[model samples]
Target: MQLGCWQDCIGAIDGTHVSAWVTGPDTATYFGRKYCHTQNIMAACDFDMCFIFISCGWEGSMHDSRIFNEILINDNVTFPHPEEGKYYLVDASYPNRVGYLALFKGNRYHQQQFRRSQQNRTAKTSRELFNKVHSSLRSVVKRTFGAWKNRWGFIRDMPRYDFANVQVLLVSASMALHNYIRRNTGNPTTVHLICDEEEAMTIVNAIPEVEHDNDDLMVGDEDPQMALMRLRIRDKLVYLRNNGMLENI
Candidate 1:
């Protein structure tokens, strides 16, 4: 994670909904916000676009934060957890907690916004600049998801299986294969081939809206300790930017 001032960042965490076919009593449980039966697949990926952790089998209707807290947090999953002073970059769907660093909500923090700022060469405010860097670094997770789904057609539209557990197994196997290919080949062209510009843009635009019911209560109620930590990190990033350390990137 060589994200300028965010070098302590271990990885990025996010969730992607995979279409699933279900019937009978379980259909209602799998019906998701997209008006389709699906499975919410949560994953953590490093800066190199390699998946470090993945958790599937959660119902599509489940909130990302809930899946994270229940499956990853309560279960003591240490793979995604970072060491002291390290954190994973997450989206607005997750809380701005100590171990997780979320972008500044209600602010411009997307690739489009960053590109526009770069084109104008406009000196951005501290928060805007922080968000610019945050968005760029976090995009790796989105690209990884897009490339994985594009590489494996089954994940894009999973077929109806006799057993629901098979869906989970398929997803696990796909991720394992994805990692194997990435490690053995040591080539980024494979990832780029799967996730073209159009496909990547589609995935970015298709990101599900934040679940208001799950996030509304926590909005604007950030813990004082966590708030201070964010401030320190933001200031350090600004310092790095001022010193021209990030201009090349």
Candidate 2:
């Protein structure tokens, strides 16, 4: 909502590869497209950059869609089921299912960040408006991940530790402490590491080297109710923009 999204936009969800040093046979399982031993850490964070949910300990080779489906089916996962009419922003890699909003398929939407030349990028249609708004709001998770990694040097140059403890201790503890600093501070952004690195830690699929998966995307069969919700949101965003209630972004 802070990014001009509707009140129903609760937060953003995405997966990141936490670099690790695993021994022996586990190296093969942990090696991903980035050519490093990483554990796929799926997390959800709100506008305040607090990780409200985290599912770690997955192999880096595992696809996000596969992990997401597994989390849904597995009764053990305490996935925070959103209240009715609320949803979390996800990327093209995730399915457009209930409680998870994604970009509108077949639309020419903006990427993670905009260039100076693309500043004039406007929504000519309702679908474009929805796409623009959704993409902007969904970027919170990327920014949160960026700040988290930047604040903790250990995540970048990880030291040797038990593979299981890497997820439970380092990953979870970092996020928990990140939340503490973020919540306790007046300006959390100011406390972010004074580094020269990029600010947005986008999903791997958004990277040029890592290719996007074709199957299980939003283009496939999705929840009928969610499809309708997307339509309504598209129309609503256009309406708000036309009346000057919403910005062209």
Candidate 3:
């Protein structure tokens, strides 16, 4: 898959807080560790990075994974599971599951992105590799969230009514609209979401260049450090090569 995931990826999962203008007794429930009072919204995106799920109105104090488990369970959501099976990408704040890939401390995604950065302020192989791979694929989900928030700005300005109910409706409507856009527009934005095997192969064959830069990172020539960097870069390059995304150019 373009995401380097199995073809059945239902997309990445993440939560964002929509700031509210009103606060009262419920503020404590809605105010999260981030020190902000808002409604938490959990969302799912597909391969094309379109939002397929958006559950909102939960107090910000709730964990993202819990919100997902509560609202997006079977029967409630109408979307069919991917043929290979459905899975989602989530941050460390989420627990791992057969249906979800969690970015925890030991996870390749997080370790490569954060571990080395913590130990070495400058250059780290894993960091470089993570950045490279992250830039390439992770942007899809991020962009999806950005677009959703942009379209549903009302999520932030919830009226002083039953904030919870309004929040739910807003999220549901947003997702429905997102799906509508994909279906009506024929995936003009995705280019190839529901492509046939041949079409998928064609896309796979069109390898894009991997944009990597070694200049900004500081490489320390020492034991464990240099070795770590080498290992990270090696692994990352291997992945890129396997994906046929490294451009000869």
Candidate 4:
């Protein structure tokens, strides 16, 4: 968690799709990428490589920011932040919110810098070294997702359960089991989660409901407030891009 020191460390936030086998005339609803219905799961994991919170069972149709608003931000979860304040890492798809920090998108320079830092190799400067070390620490949670899906086939292919609620219970049980094994065995490398954005997007975009819609509009047009909110986020994203704080444009 120490990027030069713990002061700059924050947990990373990301989501993945968990496939589940569902039934009824709603069978089409369960068919997700590669022919499966995906449940979007989000989690926050600290620098210690431990999970702070995890939420799942969201229909694949929901956007990342909307899920964060409903499950994490509005849900009233709190975390201990460094002196600078609490922050979480998220992707470009998320909204520009107050409590979390997002990686910048659209800048090749920043992206290259980040990629080099992520490798955790020796760097010329202390700041670069810290960035690499800190990024590696946050990578544990991403690995967890990989282990969950690969080791537990139920996650890769939804298990046949009597009800969707039961399917959820099974998923939770699998996660709990994963935690138990990791804690008792003291093995951090037991699982590996795929971090490739293209792979993730393939599954996420497979959902028919999401494929058909581009915006969250209730009617033909967005409300003024909603439009403004979108504009504000866009501006903030641009600001982050202009600053070296974010790497994407």
lDDT of each: 0.72, 0.73, 0.56, 0.52
Against the true structure, what is each candidate's TM-score? 0.78, 0.81, 0.60, 0.57
Candidate 3: give the clashing pairs.
none
lDDT preference between candidates 1 and 3, better one = 1
Candidate 2 residue lDDT tens string, 127-183: 777877777667778889999999998888778888786544788898899899888
- For residues 129-154, write the lDDT of model 1, one tens digit per residue: 66677777788899889888889998
Off by over 4 Å in 3: 1-6, 21-24, 69-86, 104-135, 185-187, 191-249
Task: Put down candidate 4 lDDT per residue, 1-249, tens digits, no spaces.
Answer: 022122233567877778766667866654545445777777776544455677767766566667776765353655333334445655555543444544322322122455565453333332233233334544666766776677687676665775457887787677777667667776654223344445544543332331113353223223334333333333333333344433321
For model 4, the stretches where C-alpha displacement exceeds 4 angstroms are: 5-8, 24-35, 73-84, 109-138, 188-249
How well is each residue in 142-214 modelled by candidate 3, as lDDT tens digits?
6777776787767656666655566567666876786677677766554244446666556544544344455
- How does model 4 fare in lDDT? 0.52
State which candidate, 3 or 4, has the greater TM-score: 3
Which regions of candidate 2 are displaced past 4 Å?
A: 1-5, 112-120, 188-219
Assess candidate 1 and give its lDDT.
0.72
Give the least accurate 10-residue stretch of model 2, judged by summed lDDT.
196-205
